[model samples]
Target: MIDLFHCFGAKPAHRVDTSLAAEMLRASGCRHLAVNTHTIDQVTAGDDLPVGYDTATLGSVMALVGEELALSPVLNINHPTSAAEAVKRTRQAAQLTGIRVIKLEVLDPGFKLSVNAEVVEAARELTADGFEVWPLITPDARTFAQCVELGSTMVRVMGSPIGARRGIEPQHLEPMGEMLVDSPVPVMLDGGIGSTADVEQAFALGFQSVLVNSCLFADGTDPVTALAGFRATVDRVASGTPAAH
Candidate 1:
């Protein structure tokens, strides 16, 4: 299942982005819609955004995406935080949105990028709470193994220049796949998953699922058509058919 994520923050680069993304996401064959805890925290204050986003907070967005859309809601607790605090926040999110899986934004946001100890601890705690944890991490052998050891049900691999829309580079794929080949847990590809071809490539490299954004909705790419391709590819891959070239 593809988990397509978007921030849709109070101050997005473009207001149209917030609305356009929401529209595209509804049509996209995404299994889950994810937002970080910070956004959820802001919206709970009862006033922080304009019309398109005013009603699109975490809880409402969760409700807005029903089964017909084939969309589930997920919360990403991405912030500098302790294990206990992260678990508390996740419990709050689960109460609010009924989200199934929680993503630990364990990786810091700045010049230096690495998964700190807090996130690993949080993953352990959340797993102990019987909550599935999806920790976002860069493509690294050691980190990947560590997350696997921590009982991560799935680890979402981030693109370099993380969150900078750079997507995943070609050189990384082979190495990333090699590092993750024998992982017991399924790995979800996060960055540079652009087309049906990308879906095929990711699966070939052992990705059980992927998270896609930017490529489909941005650059005037006709999101509905793009979304349809992804849907078909995911179906084909999941069904054990030969990956469509």
Candidate 2:
């Protein structure tokens, strides 16, 4: 069966009440929550969040969410000025929060090939330090190979541009799925997932798991109802029910 990893908390724009999201996810029988720390952006912008919004708070919230649900907080280092800074911040966040799986963002708008080396190095360092490194990169086959070569525990492919509510970009899905099929590490679909149709499409495309954020907290949808619908869709697809064309 395909596992569902819900993005329980996210940046302020996609943020939901962490506790409430967790409760709904648990009730829906969801087993994973990828909380977003957004460290690079927050630290670079010098933004001060409430106590409960901090990395440590994420751990506390996850603990409160109960032991059954595995919580992996996404430690996005999208804005790191240098490779060393990325490694440093990753280590610091892991140390502070005790989160084992660290999700690195290497697909910033300003992404350059030059930074790939740096990101690879940071992944190596994090892995050496006993952290499970999951780099969020563009869905390019070469990039996916590079991440595996760099010791990434898993690869997260963006279904569309991050925070774009337009849903999965159809043209990109097949190619990305092909790349994922050949990846040495597990590949997860992240971002731009807006409905059960999106989830159905993701599974059909061979993604074993998905990370959804905005869809759950979208305006006009009741969060609990939305989650339950997603759970049902996952079940239907897993059970071999045909997706509507």
Candidate 3:
């Protein structure tokens, strides 16, 4: 089955309530949920959140959601930064939250990453400390091979430019798909997933999971409703049911 992984980013006003968000996600058919600490300030500020509700509490809430849902530690340790500090923060967050995987996104151009070595090294350092690191990088097979060598258990390839929902760029997916087919680890697709058709297209090309953020955090929409919509589409696509629109 093609798993649906929801990424909780910045939330707009009239956003989904935390309790409802938790309930809906638990009821939804998604395999995993990635609660992003990176955008918490943009989404919810002091007094705007429910009592005792904060980004740090999200991990425990998601944990109560179910064992099926794995909370991804959103570490945005970009390039040219202190790799040790990044690793220390990531390790502290993981140790405090008791989550298993830390998700890293590379913010550089080209098919191969050149500017995010520190972030990569930090992830490597954390992995050596018994943490599972999942870094999202370009779809280049060679770069991904190096990532595997660096102790990344899962690698996410952008289906399109991040946050642009133009749908899966099938050409970019071909080599990554082939690489995923031969690798023992999971290869996930992030960005550019617009509908059920897109999910099926990616799954057929050998992606193990889809990470969605903007699609689920729609304006004036609650997480429960948005998640239900995405869950339905993911199921239909996984079951070979023709996509609607």
Candidate 4:
């Protein structure tokens, strides 16, 4: 059965803010959270930004998240320009940190098909080393197929532009969902899921999970409440209860 994951990026927000995102998910009764290390500055500075003791710092905080919040933090090794440094961090994240999922945002903006192919090759090397890699990318079936071949544990499909709340554009998803149904590996939907209906749509399409972010926090809707609604909706869809289909 697929599950919901509360998304949290532990940026410079006060410890309180970071804690709040988790607390909100806990209150809403989620068993998992997709924690992130990717921040705007980190993306902008590329690989030279100081990561320092932040690894231990993040790990300590996640370890504190009791049994209820099953944390699967996604460590972003996004900088393609510094593949070596990114790879080092990935090894560190897998070995030292509480991170189990290595979310490789390897595809930098303006990446051509060939560049994406190269990223897949690099990711293949990582997966060969026993790391469960989850490449954060578009919902392209070809890419999904390549990722599966490269040994990714799962694939993440961006539902909209990064954090935009366009609400899982049905047109964009049609092809992605088609791929999910055909692909052997599980697919996780990310970006732009604004409501319970969106969750329902993803589950019905055969996706194993959805990565919801901005919409839950930015809107006045409480994360817990939103989670409850999503959980209920996903359950119904999974059970073949059918949402008036």
In order, how many clashes per candidate?
A: 0, 0, 0, 0
At residue 143, candidate 2 shows an lDDT of 66
How much does each candidate deviate from the true structure in C-alpha RMSD? Answer: 4.4, 4.7, 5.4, 5.6
Per-residue CA lDDT of candidate 3, range 1-245, in tens?
47877655433342444565566567565544444433333433222222122433454554465455553334432221355655665555554446566776545543223234655676678778877777766567776777788888887777776556666775775777667778878888876665556767778788878876655545445656766776786777668887655
- How well is each residue in 1-245 modelled by candidate 2, as lDDT tens digits? 38676654344554355566566666567654444444433542212212123333444555576465664445555446456777787766655556677767644444421244556767778788877788766567776787787688777777776556555687776668677675667778877787777887778777877777667767756667777888888887788887667
Give a tens-digit lDDT track for model 1, residues 65-140: 4444665556767554456667787877676656658877554545224364666777778887778888777677
- Tell me how far candidate 4 lies from the true structure as C-alpha RMSD in angstroms: 5.6
Each model's TM-score? Answer: 0.72, 0.77, 0.72, 0.73
Model 4 quality (TM-score): 0.73
2 or 3, greater by lDDT: 2
Question: Per-residue lDDT for 1-245 in model 4, tens only?
Answer: 57675554322321234455555556555554443433323433222222221332343445556444664455655444334544666765555454556766554453211234555765777787777787766666777788888889878777766556665666766678678776778788766677777777777777788876556655455656666677677667667785775
Off by over 4 Å in 2: 13-15, 38-56, 68-84, 107-121, 243-245
On lDDT, the stronger of 1 and 4 is 1
Which residue pairs does candidate 2 place in steric collision? Answer: none
Any runs in candidate 1 off by more than 4 Å, and if so which?
1-11, 14-26, 45-55, 62-67, 79-88, 98-100, 111-118, 163-167, 194-196, 236-245
Query: In candidate 2, residue 222 scores what lDDT?
Result: 68
